[model samples]
Target: MSSVLGVSVGAGTVRLARPQHGGPHGFVPPYTFEVQTLAMPEQRAEEAAADAIAAMLAAAPEVGATTITFRSDPQARAIRAAMARRQLTNYQLVPEAVAAVHFAHATTDMREVSTLAVYDLGSSGLTVSVVNARTSDVYQCERISDISGDYLDSLVREQQIASGRIAHPADPAGLAALDALCRAAKEQLSNSNAVAMPSEQGLVLLTQENFEALMMLAIESSARMTRDAIIRSQHPVQAVLVLGGGARIPLIARVLERTIGVPVIVPAEPETALARGAALLARPAQVPQAPAAPTILPLDDEADVTPAWLTAPARRRPLAALTSRSGQNRREVSAAALTVSSLVVVAGIGLGLGYGPEVLERGNSTDGSQAVPATTSPRPTQAAPTSAAPTSEAVHATVAAPPVRQLDNEPTTSAPPSQGPNTFTVVPGLPPVVLPTLPPVVLPGFPPAGQ
Candidate 1:
C-alpha cells in the first residue's frame, strides 16, 4: 500500500496533511503541520516553503506521493518547482476551492449535492467559491475584500487607544504587540463570553458581543459575498462549507448561515480539509504498469528526417543533456585541487623573493674569508677617585685618567670630557632597554588582564 502527502499553501501559512489508515473516511488526513509564510520576495518565499516541506518529509519518510493545493497559480508553480528540486516526483496540483469541495464531498453529506459553496476567511483576505461537486469545477469564485482577521484586530487596537489603555500608541513596536494581543483576544472570544487583554496600562476586557460589533462590517461583507457567489453559480447549493484561520470566529459562521439561508457546516479540523482533499486526490487509483518498448521509426531513402530546430547550424546540446552528477563532482574536485596548487605555488614564490637577499648574505658569511665586524658605539665612564691630601701629587691624582671603561675596546686618544661637581655621568648603554609591550589577551568567559 502507498500513502499520499498533501500540502496547502495559503496567504499566511502552509499546511501539510497525510491520510489516516483505519476509518471509514481514512482518506481524510488527521495529522498536519503548519508553518507561517515568510514575508519575503517570491523566490525566497518558495525556498522557505521548500524548507518546511523538507522538514516534514524528514519526520515522516513513508509518504510516497504528494499533491499541493494552492490558492493562486503562481504560488503553485513556484512551490511545485521547489518540491521537484527536492525530488518529490509523484505530485500534482489542485486549486484551493476545488480541493475544499472534494473535502466536503468526502467528509460531509454533500457527496450527493450537485453544487456547493466554500467561504475561506484567511488572514489577508476572504475568498468565496461556488463549485460543482460532481465535476469538481469552480463556477463562481470571488475574493470579497482585503479586510480580514487583521482588520478586526486593528479595530480592537483602535478601541484600546481611544480608551487610553495604551500609553504609547505612536510607538510602532508597542502597537504591533497590542495588535497581536487583540488578535489573541479575538480568537479567545470565539469560545468565551469575554477575554482579557493584558497591556502596560492594565487588563482590558473584551466581550464577545462587543467584539462582534467591532467586526460587524467585515462579517457582513463576507456573508454578502458568499451569498452572491451562490446566486451567481445559478445552481442550488445543497450545503455551504466554512473553513480557514479567519473563519474560526464563531460570528462568521452564524452570520453566513443566516445570510445564505443554508445549513452551514464547519468540519472537524476544518483547516486541514484542503490538504486532506488534495491527498485524497493524489492517492494512486491503480498500480503502475510495466514500461513500454521504445518505438522505432523507419528512415526514408530520399527525405531529410531531422527536425528543423535540431538541423539548424547554431544548434547546441541542451543544458539538461550536458549535466550529470558524476561530471559535476569531477569538475568541482578538479577546480578545488587546481586552486590549492595555485595558492601553494604563489606562496612559495613570494617567500623566496622576500628572503632571497638575507639568505645570500648569511651564505657568504659562512665562507672562511674575514667578515666585516659590526660597528659599536662608545659608552660614558665613571669619575676617578680623589685622595685627601693637600700636596700637588694628591691634587694631580684627583684629576687623573678616567676609571676603567665599561666596554672591552681601548679608550680613544681624546681630551677628558668636563664633569659636574658631584654628579656622575649616566652610562649610555647601562640604562635597561625597555621592550615594546603587547596588547592584553582576552579569554572566553573571563575579563582581560590590565594593560
Candidate 2:
C-alpha cells in the first residue's frame, strides 16, 4: 500500500493531492473536498506553501504512506525547512525543473535525451528550465536558466500592455487572475472554436486568432532561448520536449518546432506533468544513494553508439567506381614514385663516379666482359631512361684511332738514338716503279754464248 502526496501552490489556491497506489484507474474521490485558498498576507506567499503539504497529509492518512513528496518552486527551500521542523521525515523535495523531467521519463518511455526545455505557465508566474533527461538507473539532473517560461510570460504581458488591452501597468492580483483565465481559455480554445471568458468585467473572448497574436511574444522568446539551450547542451538533442500546463498550447508547439527545426512532443495530462513526474521520482524502484549521474554517458562517448548521420541513408558510391577513381590517382602516384626512384638511382651513379673504378672498367663490365659487377650500376629497365644522351661507341673509336697516329707522326728536331727502321718513316703519296724482269730472265749458259 505505497502512497505519495503531490501539492501545487498557486497564487489564489493550494492544490493538495494524494496519489494512491494499486488503485484502479478512474477511481473517484472518497468524499467531496475543497482546497482552502489563503490570502497572500497571512502566509507571506512563500510560507503559505507549507500548508498545502500539511493539508495533503491530513487528507489521506489511511494509506501506508511511507513518503510525501512535494513539487519545488522558488519557495521550496523555506517550505522544506518548515516541514523538517514538524519532524515529517518520510518526505522528499524535488525542484519543479527536475519534477518536470521525471514526469516525462515516467509517462514517456524515453531516455538519454539529456536536455529538456520545460515551460511551466501557471496562474501567477511562468517557470522554464533546461534539464537533463538521463536514462540511467541512477537518474542525473542539471539545469540551464535561459529557456525559462516565466520570461516568456513577461514578454506576453508587456505586449498585452503595449496593445492597450489593459491599463498602464498590470497589478499582481489582476495579472494572476488574467493569467488563470487565459490559461483556461487557452485550453478550451484547443478543442473549440472560441473559448468564452465569463468575468465580472464583461465577456472576454479568446479566439484562436487572438491567442496566436498574444502568444507570439511568448513563442518568439521561448524559441530564441530554446535554440540557445540546444547550442549550450553541447550534445545533439534527440527531441524538443514540451511539458507543464503551458505546453498544451498549439502556439507554443509551433514556435518550438519552427525554432528547433525538430518535432515538439506533448504528452498527456499536460497540466499535471510536473506533479506526476514528482510522484514518480519519490517512489523510484531502486534508489541508490551513490548512483551515477543519469546523463553522464553521452551518446557520442558510448562505445556501441553510432551517430544519426552515420546510421541514416548516405549517398553510397559504387566500389567499382571508387576503385576506378583510385586507380586514376594511383597512376599519378606511380608516376611520382618512378620519378623519385630514378632520382635516387642517378644520385647513386654520381656518387659511384667519384669513388668508383675507371670509366673503361665500368664500360667493360657494362659490355658484359667482367665477372665482377660494374662499380657504377646500370639503370633498371623500369627506371626512368638515362638523361645522359647515348655515347656512340662508333664515333668514339673513330676519334681515338686518329689521336694515336697523330702522336706517332709528331716531328722532332733531333734524330733517333738508334738508327732503327722506325727512324726513317716513309711517307706514302709517291709514284710506282716498273722492274726489268724480261732482260734478266735468260739462263746463265745462254747469256755467256750470246756475250
Candidate 3:
C-alpha cells in the first residue's frame, strides 16, 4: 500500500506523520524532533530538520511520498535543497498556514463550511490564513514574527525569574532547561488553572491567569491579524481552525473566538494536524514506462484477414492482380501506355545528346523508308589524337545537324554518320533542327539585342 510522510518544520520543532492504513478518517499521531528555532543558528536549525526527516524515513521505509510544511519561502527552499541533497523524490512543499487549514478541513467539523480563518501559533510566531474551506484553498495569509508561542515562553521565563523561583538564569544549560519547563507549564495551564515545573533552583509554579497575563498582548495581536485576514479574503468565515504547538494554549483559542466572533476548532492531535494534512496531499510519483512493442504479422502468411461483414458480400481479389490486368479500364490502360511512351522518348533523347546523333540513324534507312543495319565500331585502345582545325564544310556540318528525333523505343546499336547537304553529317532518322546558340532576332527599338 502507498503511504505519504507529512513533515511540519516549525520554529521550535519538526513533526512527521504517516496515515495509518486502516485507521479512522482524520486520525493519526505524529513524531516530533525537539529543536529550538530562535536559540540555534540557521544552519543548525536546517541540520536538525534534515536529521528529523532522515530519522522518519529510516523508521517508515514504506513511505512513497513526502510533503513538507514551511512558514516562509526561504525556509521552504532550504528544506527542499536539503531533501534534494538526500536524493528524496516525490516530495512537495506547502506553507505552514495552508497545511494547517487543510488539516482543519479534514479533521475538524468545518468540512461543510465554505470559508474559514486559520490561526497557527507556532513557537516562533503566529500565522493567520483565510481559507476557502470548500476548495481547501488559502486565499490570503499573514504572519507576525514577533507575537508567538516562543514570545510567551520568554515572558513566562521572565515572570519565573522575577518571582525568584530559580537561580543561574544566565547559564546556557539552565536557560534551556527552564525554557522546556516553561513550555510544559504553559501546556499544562491550558488544561488546569495552574501547573508546576522543576527548575535548577526549585519547583516553579505557574497559574493559568498568570500565563494569560503574560501572553495576552500576543494573543490579542494574533486575533486582530486573523480578523484582518478574514476581512481581506472578502468571504464569510464560518469557523476558525487553530493548530501548532504554541496554539495548544486554551487562552489563545478563547481570545480568537471572542475577537473573531466565530467557533474555534482545535483538532484532537493539534501538533500532527499539519503533518497529517500534508500527508493527505502527498501522491506517489509516476514512473513512465516505455510503450509496448507493436504486434507484427508475416508478409508471406495467407489467410482470410478481412472482417466477416466486409467479406460477406463477395470474395475480394488481391489488389496487385486486379490492378495489373490489361483490360481493367480503358482510361487506366491509356494512362499507363502514355507514361511508358513518354519515358522511352526521354531516354532516347538523353542518349542522343551523350553519344552524338549517330545513335538515331539506326532506326531508319538511308532513304528514310526502312530500318538500316547499324554497324558498331571497335572502341579505341588509346586516346584518339585531336584533329586539326575544321574546314568550312566540317564547321557547317557541326552547326547545321538536324535536331534529334524522339524514338519510339530504345535503340540496340548506333548508326554511322553519312554526308548530307553542304557536307554536313546527318543521322537518317532525325529531322532538321535550328541551333539554340543562334543570335536572337532583334527589333528596332530593343537596344540592339545584347545591349
Candidate 4:
C-alpha cells in the first residue's frame, strides 16, 4: 500500500499529517503526528494558499501520496485554482466535515451516532456543519465570519487600549506585537483563571472571568446558531464534535453543551482533528467485510473501519503527480510570498482592524450563504449585524455510500498544545519548519501561558 499524507487547508493556516499504521481499529496515539506550523497570508487569494501548501510539501519530504480537505466550496475552488497556477492537475479536495467524521468513526463511539454537528471555530471564521455520519451528506451548514478567533483577538486589543496597557503603536510591527500579546492572553484565559504577561510597555493581566465576559455575547450568539443547526439537521444528532483552534476555550464548550443539549465531544487536540482524520482517510486499508453465504458472524466494529462515502473521496482524490518531492520541484517558487515584518500572531485579524462581523457576513440563512471572492482591501468599518432567515428548507445533499460503523473505540493522539491565541498552530519557539523570511521573536519577562 502507498503511504499518504493529509493536509488541512484552513483560511489562516495549513496542517499536515501522516499516519504510520492503518486498520479497522483506525490510527491511534503515536501512529499519527500532525504538523501545523505554517501560516498562510490572507491578502492574496490563491497565491497565498499555493505558497503555503507548497511550502508544507517541501518541509515534509517523506510524503508519497497526499489528500487535502476543504469546508466550503470556495476553499475547494481556491485550492483548485492554486493548483492550476502551478499546473498541478493531480490533486483532490475533500469536505472538511467528512474528514472529521472519518476521524470520529475511528476515535469516538459510533454505536449511537447517525447524524453529527461539526462546530469549528477557527481563526478566520465559524463553520457549523450538520452532516449524516452514515452517508456523509451535508444536511445544513453555515459560516459566521464576524465571530472568529481573529475577531475575538481584536476585541481583546480594544479592551487593552481602553485599559491603558500601552499606546497603540501606529506602525505595523507595534500593532502586531500588541495583537500577539492580546491573543496570548485570550488562549491562556481558556485554560487558566488568570494570565499575566509582560509587554514592551507594561505587565498585562487578563482573568478568565474578564475574558469570558468580553466574548460571552458573541459566544452565546454562536450557541444559538448551533442549536438551530441541530434542529434544522432534521435528524437526531447523537453528538456535537467541536473542532478548531478556538474550540480550546472551555467556555465555548460549556455554552455549546448547555445550548445544544447534546453531548459535545472534543478530540485530544481539537484543532488538528480534521488533519488527523485526513491522514487516516489518506491510508489505503483492508476493510473487513461481512461474510457472504448467510454465515453467523459477530459485528466486529474494530476490524471494519470502512466509511462508504468517505473512502470514495479519499480514493478518488489520489493524484499521481502531487507527491512531496515532485510537487515542490515542479512549481513552488512561482508565487511571491510577501513575508510579514515581524513574528506577529494574526489571531486578532478580523476585528483587530477595527471592524465588525457585519463586514464579514455576506448573507446567513438556514442553510448558509454562498462564498464570494475575497477582496484585498480591509473590511469596511463596523456596522449593524445583518442576518437573513432561512428562506427554504434544508436540503440533504449526499455525496456517496456506506456509513462509518467502527467499534466504540476511544481514539488517542500525541498532539502538542500548538493552537493558542497568539499563534494559529505550533508551540511557541518550536514550530515544525520555520519560514525563512519571518523569524521568531524573543520576549523577556512574559510567561508563555498557553504553551
Would you estimate the TM-scores of all the predictions?
A: 0.57, 0.48, 0.59, 0.58
Best by TM-score: 3
For model 2 the TM-score comes to 0.48
Q: Per-residue lDDT of 176-261 in model 3, one digit per residue for the tens?
A: 78888888888887679989867667788999788788888878877887888788888878888888787688887889889988
Q: Between 1 and 3, whose TM-score is larger?
A: 3
The whole-model C-alpha lDDT of candidate 4 against the native structure comes to 0.71
Tens-place lDDT per residue, model 2, 1-451, is 4455554544434444445443212233331122233445424544565655555566656423322223344456666677676655556666666666665665565654656666565544445455566732212223334433344445444545565554432467777666555456667776786766655433446567876776687568757765775576564455666765567677888887877776677876565555555444454233459867756555555575545566433424465678899999999999999999997886566455442232344355444333334374644322333354334463344223321212234563444344433344344433223332444456766755457
Model 1 global lDDT (CA atoms, 0 to 1): 0.69
The root-mean-square deviation over C-alpha atoms between each candidate and the true structure, in angstroms, is: 34.5, 21.5, 21.4, 54.4
Q: What are the lDDT figures for the candidates, one per model?
A: 0.69, 0.54, 0.69, 0.71
lDDT for 168 in candidate 3 is: 50
lDDT of 1 by residue, 210-267 (tens): 8888888878887887787788778778778888767678888889888888878787
Q: Model 4, which residues run further than 4 Å from truth?
A: 21-31, 44-49, 52-62, 284-451
Off by over 4 Å in 1: 22-45, 84-87, 168-171, 284-451
Which scores greater on lDDT, model 2 or model 3? 3
Which candidate's lDDT is highest? 4
Residue pairs in clash, model 4: 146-357, 301-407, 308-402
State which candidate, 1 or 2, has the greater TM-score: 1
Q: Please give the distance, in angstroms, between residue 15's alpha carbon in candidate 2 and its true position after superposition.
A: 4.1
